[model samples]
Every structure is written in C-alpha cells, then in structure tokens.
Target: MISKWFDERLELQKFKDKFLNKAFPVHPTFLLGEVALFSFVTLVLSGIFLGLLYEPSTGKISLFGAMVPAAYASVVKIDLLPLGVIVRRIHHWSAMIMIASVIAHLARVYFTSAYRKPREINWLIGLGLLGITLGAAFTGYLLPYSQFSVTATSIAYYISKSVPWVGDWIARLLFAGEFPAHATVPRFFFLHVMVIPAVLVSLVGLHMLVLIKQKHTEPGANRKRKEARGGQRLIGIPVWPEQSYISVSLFFFLLFVVVLMATYIPLNPIETFGPPSPVTPVMRPDWYFLPIYGFLKLIPGDLSISIAGAKIGPEAIGGVFFPGILAFILVAIPFLDRASEAHNYIENPLHRPFMTSAGIAVAAFLFMTTVSGYIDVLHIAPASMAIYVVVVSAAAWVISYLLLRRYGRAVKKGEHVES
Candidate 1:
C-alpha cells in the first residue's frame, strides 16, 4: 500500500525508467569515480567527529597548565580522545585517496577521449571538483596550527600576494591579515568546514546529473555492438540491482581499506611539530602541491616584470601564471579536439600516438618537477634538476610515440597486441 501510494503521487515508473534502470558499464576504471565518492563521504563523517571537538582559533588557551593556541590545544585534546588517532588518520588517508582517485579518473577519461562533444561541460565540472578538493586539503592543513603547517601555508600567503594588481587585497582577504593572525584560523575553519564542503557537494550532484544525461563513455567494443543493433541502446548491467550491489560492495571494501590504512599508517602528529612559531621549520608541502613548489623553486628569485603599474615577480610567474596556463589548456582540450557529431566510443591511446606522447611528456615534466621540489632536503643542484626535467620529458615523448607507432603498424599486419 505504501509503495502504491508513493508510486501514484511520484510517478515511480517514470523515475525507474529514467534512473533506476540505467546501464552501468562493468569496468574497473569506472570504479575510480565510486572510490572518490565514497572517500568524500568518509571525509565528511570523520570531519563531523573532529569538528565537534575542534576549537578553530589561535588565541591562547590553558592546556595542561600551559597556554597554547586554541586551535593547537583542541587538536591536542582530540589526540587524547579515544579513537581520535585512528579517526584523524582515516580522515587524512581518505583525502589522499579521494584526490588520487579523482586524478586517476581524469587521466582515464583523457586517454580515452571521453571529454568529447556533449561531455565537455562535465569535464570542466570534474576539474572544478579537483580544485575544491585541493582547497579543502590546504585549509585543513592549517587547522592543526603546527609550525610545519604554518610555514608551508605562509608560502601560499606570499604567492597569493604575488598577483600583479590586486595581490595585497586578495592576500589580506584570504588570510584575514598577516597570516597566522588571530582571525586566520577561524577564516580557514569556516571555509574548510562549511563553505568549501557546500560547494563541493553541489558540484558533485551536478556532475552526476550531467553524467546521467550524457551517459557513461564505454569501451570501443561497445560502439561495434551499437552499430550492429541499429540503435543507440547502451549495453551494460541495469542500475537497479546489479550495479547497486556492485556499488555497495565497492563502498564497503573501500571503507575497510581506509580503516586498515588508518590502523597501520600514522599521519600529521601535531605534537611533534608543536604550536605555530616564528622559527620556521625546514618542511615541504604535501605531494599534490609538489609540482607547484618545484616550479616556484625553479624560477629565479630576481625575476620580475612591470606592466600597467603592476609588478609581477617570480612568485606570480611560478605559482599563478604557470598553473593558470596548465588549467587553461585542460579547460580548452575538448574544444581543441572537437568532434562534429556526438562521439561516445573510447579511443585507443596507442592509435593516437601524438596525444598519448603529449600526455607522457606532461607526466614526465610533472614527475621531474616534483622531484625538484625536494632539492633542499635532497641536497640537489638546481641546474642539474632543470636539465633532468627537460631531458626526461623530451625523451619520454620520443620513446612513447615511436613505440605506439610500431604497435599500430604491427596491428595493421594482423599481429596481436597486448596492453
């Protein structure tokens, strides 16, 4: 009776036909999106527990007969709470995994040419999600109020102020005065706990709606099947039971793995770093930000340009302009590789040697720059690192292109190829 009444009012059959029975491809790469989704859910749940106990302020507070920053004191209390250690670890690992899965998902989509035609908007949305995820990580890093995190974030403070005309205004707005000021923690706390999360959740919803409308991109084999059928019907398990079961199982497995990692792996022990101090520690930013850090290091410190009464410095060049260019290229990709008609089939990267080689080259540059980011700790020379970056990236492009072309030729001659 409850089902019948709901069905009558909600038009349940139409809803089922639109969503519940939609096709879901059975591919392992497709699971990366689910991993990101589940990890974000885990982050939210764990963040709630942390938020309840956290005091987001830098003002002095009595802790164990000594005064410390309220933000640091609260984190210390959280550490003493039962299961707090594990919960914090879970949150950290979930963020790490969430970022990793999103990057992997984006790479899969790129290599397969899944951003073509109608799906371009979704691609941009995915990029927006990544930017917000990084922002979340950055803000959360400062909540511990440790020396390491403060020093690292201060790098960002200067970078923000490196923008030509409005640098000072934007830096003051973002950091709420000289960073590490009384208001800085509360501002970041608001963004981390409330504003950013709201935006992220809304974007995720829009991403899903776009996905449902455009439908998931499938393997090249699916195109052959569709052509044979003389219609655009997708071939996959229905969303109602089969895909639902798979999704549920995947979520549980991911949860288990995250918990296991939390149990075994340690992260961000605030006590070691202690409270924020004027004496900066020799530390590096997280892995995701390493490329930017490296790029910053690569640029000459004396480099500066003046235009329209605005001074542009090395910090702006490396931190703002370089990253902006990369982002612009990513946003412009679908337009650059435009298709006249709706193209749903996955393209084999091996069949498109130029594009694949370009990806490999970019990956090489990023990897080498990341290595250069650790030059101070690694005791490596800057000139040597720059030489390595150029040499390795060019070599990667050449080798990958030649190998892919040879593979294409072999396939034309009826020789079987693997991977």
Candidate 2:
C-alpha cells in the first residue's frame, strides 16, 4: 500500500529506472568501497547505542565499589550490560575494518590510475574520508579514559605542540587549557559523537552523488567508450538486485567477522589498565598510526630547527611536514600524471612504470615503519633499530627500481614489435 501510494504520486518507477537500477561494475576489487560504506553504517548504529550510556564527563565517580573517573565508570557500566562489551567490540572492529578497507580502496584507485580527469574531485573526497576516519578513531580512543588512552593522548598533545609559533596555541585549543583539563573529555566527546560524524556523512553523500553523476570508472572503460556511445550497452548488474545482493552479503560477512573477533580476540582492556595517572604507560597508536609513530622515534626527541625563533622539532617532521608532503603529492596526482591525456581507463600496473614504482616504494616504507613501531615496544637495541631501518630502505628502493627497469624494457620491446 505504501509503495503504491508513493509510486502514484512520485513516479517511483521512473526514479528507479533512472537511478536505483543503474549498472555498477562488478569486481572483487570494487568491493572495498562497499566494505567501507557498510562498516560506517554499522558504526553509526553501534555508536548511537553506546552514546546513550556513555558519560562524557571526566569527573571522578564510583565504579565496582571504588572511585573512578566518570568516563571510565560509565564505560565499565556499559561493559557490564548483557551485550555492551560485544557492541563496543563491534564498534572498535568496525572502525578498524573501515580504515583497512578505505586504505585498500584508495590503493586500488591509485594503482589502477582511476583518479584521473573527471574523477579528481572523488579522489579528493576519498582523502577527506581518510582524514575524517583518523579523527574519529583518535577521539573515540579517549572515551575509555584509561591510563593507556590518556598516555597515548599526551603523545598526540606533544606532537601538536611540535608545530612552530602556533604549536602551543594548537595544543592549548585542543585540550581547552593544560593537559587533562576539565574541558578535554567534553571537547572530544562532542567531536566524536557529533561533529566529525556529521562531516563524514556529508562528504560520503557528496562522494556518491559525484560517482553516480560521473559513472564508475572500470578497468577497460576506455575500450568500451565507443561501443557505449553506439548503444551497445555495458556488462554489469543493476543496483536494484544483483549489485544490492553483493553489497548486502559483504555487510553481513564483515559483521560476522567482527563479532567473531570480538568474541575470541579481545582488544583495549581498560579494566586492567585502570585510570589516568602522572606516569604514562608504553604508548602506541593503532597499526595505521604505527608508521608515523615509528618515524617519530627515529628522530631525537629534542631535535629542532629555529626559523626566526619559531622552533620546528622532530614532531614537525614526522607529524606535520612528512604527512603534509605525502598528502600534497597524493592530491596532486590527477594534475601531475599526464593531465592533458589521462583517461578513466585504468592501465595495467606494469604499463605505468613511474606510478607502479612510486606506489610500491611508499607502501614499503610505511610497512617497514610499522615494523619499527612494534620493534620499539620490545626494547630492541639501538644498533638493531638502525640496521632494520637501513635494510628496509635499501630493500624498498632496490625492489622498486628493479621492477620498473625490467618492466620498462619489456614495454619498449612490445611497442617495437608492434611497430
């Protein structure tokens, strides 16, 4: 009855034919984007439930017959609920999966050279989503208000203070006063539960709208262009059923995996870590942040440069400048890589030597840096750390160079034979 009523007034069939039933490219690689979107949906549902019981205040309160910070106590209370722990676990696992899938999605876009011409804005949107994901994770981590959370946050605070003249100002703004001020929890709470999520949703909607307007770029989109214009049509399933089924399947699969992990493999046990304190525990960010964390450890803590009395330290290098450069390069790819001639068709990795080599080198560096972050926690010797760093750098460069050189010759030979 509802469907008929809406269809009569709104011409629902027309809308469905025009948009809902649009064809989408079918491929395993394309599933990464769907994974990210569905995980976000799960996050929103779980976040709403958790938010109902979570007290954002950091003020002291009683928990389990002992006094604890309100934030910690609230979290404990929630955990004690029949399924609170599982829900929280699901939220955490969802965030992890979202981050991983987003990374995988971006990598697919990059390696395939899909971020070209008309798709540039979508690429920028993808970058925004990545930034927002990191923000959400950082803020959410503090809600536990455990010793590890506080300690890890302090590292973030100091990293912020590593900026130039405005470093101190930025840190002050973030904490709302000195570190662990009364306003700290509230600020993060609002951003985590409201502001950041709102922005992410807006960007995500815009990304989808843009994608639909531009249509999805597939591996051989270029080859099919002429046929498409001649009304030959493309190969794929409609979004209403076939595509929808695939998306629904991935959603359930991700949920099951996260729930299974939550049941067996535990994470972030604050019951043991206890509340915040003067002494910071061994601080480490999630795996995604490990690269930056590892890089920061390599530079001396007090290392700095004076620019007209503005102090730029090792934090500026690892936290600010390094990431800044990488982001700039990523955003500039559409313009940098044959902008005048670039097309939506994704060329094979071997056919684009420079892009392939650069991607490999960058990914290799981050992987090695993550290894370094873990190695530091084990109290490895300075000699060993140096050796590891050198070996990683050499291996990355050597492998990338060899692949490019070998592929370049093969490509040239093929072109010569064709001519």
Candidate 3:
C-alpha cells in the first residue's frame, strides 16, 4: 500500500526529463530556499535534543534534584556533550545562514522581477517566513537565561511597553509579569518550541506550494516570452536527485561551518548581568534587534504633547508606529510596483528605485542604530549617531528620487525613438 502510494505521487519520467536533460539550466540563486530549508532542519534536530534535556518549569525546582544537567546547566552540558556542542553550533550557524539566505533570495527575486503578478503571493509568503525566522531567533535567545538573555528580555519588555493601548497588556502576555519570573521562561519556551515552529512550518509549506504552482522566474530576455504570453506555463527544473544533490551538498557544508563556530566561539553566556534588573545600564539586545532599540533611544524625551487630554511620546510614534508602517510598506511592495515591463537592474531604474533605495535606507538605519547602541553602552553620545542616521537616510531618499526621474526620462526617450 505504501509502495503504491509513493508510486502514485512520483513522476519519475518528468523528473528525469527535467533534471537529466542538460538543456535545463539551474541558477545558483535557486539554492537559497534550499539553504533555508536545511537551516530549518538543523533547528528542528537541535531543538528536539535540547528539549529532551531542558526543564521548562519556572517553579523553584531543586538544582540538586537531578544528577543530570538542569535548567541553565543543562544547556551548558549540552554544549559539552560529545556531539551536543556540535549540534548547537550547527543550529546557531544554520540560523545565521538561513536569515542571510532568505535576504539574498528576496534580493534575487526583486532584481530578477520574479515577484510579478502570479508570484506576488509567494513574495508575501517569503516575507512572512522572514518575520517568523526573526521571531524564532528572538525566542531562542532567551532559552539560555544568561546575562545577555536577561538584558535582551529587558529591552524587549521596554519595546512591548511602548505599544500604545495594548503595550502593558502585551508585555504581561509575553513575560507573564513585571519582570523575569517562572512564567517568562515557560512562555518563551512554549513559543520557541511549539508555537513559532508550527507557524513557521505552515508558512514554509505554503511558500513551497506557491513555488511549485507558480514555477521559478528566470532573468533577462528568457523571462520576457513568459511575461508576453501572460505566464501560462512554468519554466524550471525538478526538485529531485539533481537539485537535491546540490542542495544537500550546500547544507552539509553549512553544517560543517556551524559546527566549527559552535566549537570555537560558542554561545556566550552573559554571566555579568546577574539577573533582570531595570537599573542596569549595560543592557542591550541581540545584534539583529539593536536597530529598534537604537530608534527608541534616538527619540527626544520632550517630543511629547497632549492631544485632546491624552499624552503621547516620541518613542511611541518613532519606534512603534514608524517601524510598523515600514513593515506594512515592505509587505505591500507587490501592489506598489505596478510596472509590467521586464528589465534587469541596469535597464530599469524607475520601476524598482523605491525597493533598492528602501533596502539601502534600512541597511543604513540598522547600521547607525547598532553603532549608536554600542556608543550608548560605552557612555558616549548616541545622539550624534542618531543624527547621522537621519541625515544619511534623508540623503538616500533624495538621491533615489533623482534616479527615478532620470529613469523615467530615459524610458520616454526610448519610446519616442522607437516610434
């Protein structure tokens, strides 16, 4: 019965014709999704092993009760366990690679005009996956309960508190109280272990389904025919032994790298921070989230006023609203870019200027914010960094607009010449 089921699903001839036919060319960029998948696999494997040894209870359990590793010590022991450290190393490294690959894949999709028409839904799914990946990282960071984790959670708490009407409520929902308690660990553990993974898996499956249905978009003139014909057919290779070979090779290479980093650098435990304390000045979140934290600090404390007897702070407007708006804008890019022309980066600037500029602006903003946070931690003036970020962001926007104008003129000139 299993054999019949497998045979019914497998299209051996189609797989052979698609992959074995030397005519079909596979772009190196296609491997990005595979890398992400491999990372997810690594996450699952390491997570399962860690889960077995981990004690999720926040209630005061005796440190002396179990002869085996417990709580914080369990993680440390996992790192020391023959292949345990390697597993974590692979997991951590895979996460970094996964995030990076996802970004790279998005860039490839944008530059190649793959997010057009029928593929827009896939792009949105990709965006959702990106958010989930970041959330997974955030939740995973809290598991070790180290000093960095404590400080990071404090910053996260503050961010949650900035959320207007539901800020405090959201904070309570997340951490379960005023500060780090038994509830905090359990809540984060549940999210990291069960909730977020389930969402990620579902989204990933949707992303794959969309990919299989829509087919991968190609670059240059090769893609023009499909666009001209309304994209009625897919043009790509099969995902079997052919692409699988390359995918598995890349995954193992990355796994080796992850093991190397885990063994060498290891995950740092913030021993100095002691426990969650609001008075602590050295508090900072993981590097990935430093941008938001930096934005929170950059807002002027005096930039608050009473509108209709209700008070508002700059932190609320700049940190929460601005970021949320930007996220919405990013997710809505498929609708924003309405041009149907198929041109690569060099040929079409106006159509994609906003996307390119937005990417640059975000990168610059994050860099500035990260630097600003570092300076703040060192007792230096973070305001200077913030000012620089504002100046640079403004300048980038202006330059992008100018480029768009030039592109528009060029397109018009070409059209006139053809006529």
For model 2, the stretches where C-alpha displacement exceeds 4 angstroms are 221-234, 377-391, 411-419
- For each candidate, what TM-score against the reference? 0.95, 0.93, 0.80
Model 1: weakest 10-residue lDDT segment is: 410-419
- Please provide, for model 2 over 375-408, each residue's C-alpha lDDT reduced to its tens digit, 9 standing for 90 to 100: 6567876457757777776677678778878978
Q: How close is candidate 2 to the true structure, as a TM-score?
A: 0.93
Instruction: For residues 23-72, write the lDDT of model 3, one tens digit per residue.
Output: 22366566777778887888898888888887765343334453321356
Tell how far residue 78 is off in model 1, in angstroms.
Answer: 0.7
Best by lDDT: 1
Local distance difference test scores for all models: 0.89, 0.84, 0.70
Candidates by TM-score, descending order: 1, 2, 3
Candidate 2: clashing pairs of residues? none
- Arrange candidates by lDDT, highest first: which order? 1, 2, 3
lDDT accuracy of residue 30 in candidate 3: 65
Separate clash counts for every candidate = 0, 0, 1
Answer with 1 or 2, whichever has the higher lDDT: 1
Segments in model 1 whose C-alpha atoms lie over 4 Å from true places: 1-13, 415-419
Estimate the lDDT of model 2. 0.84
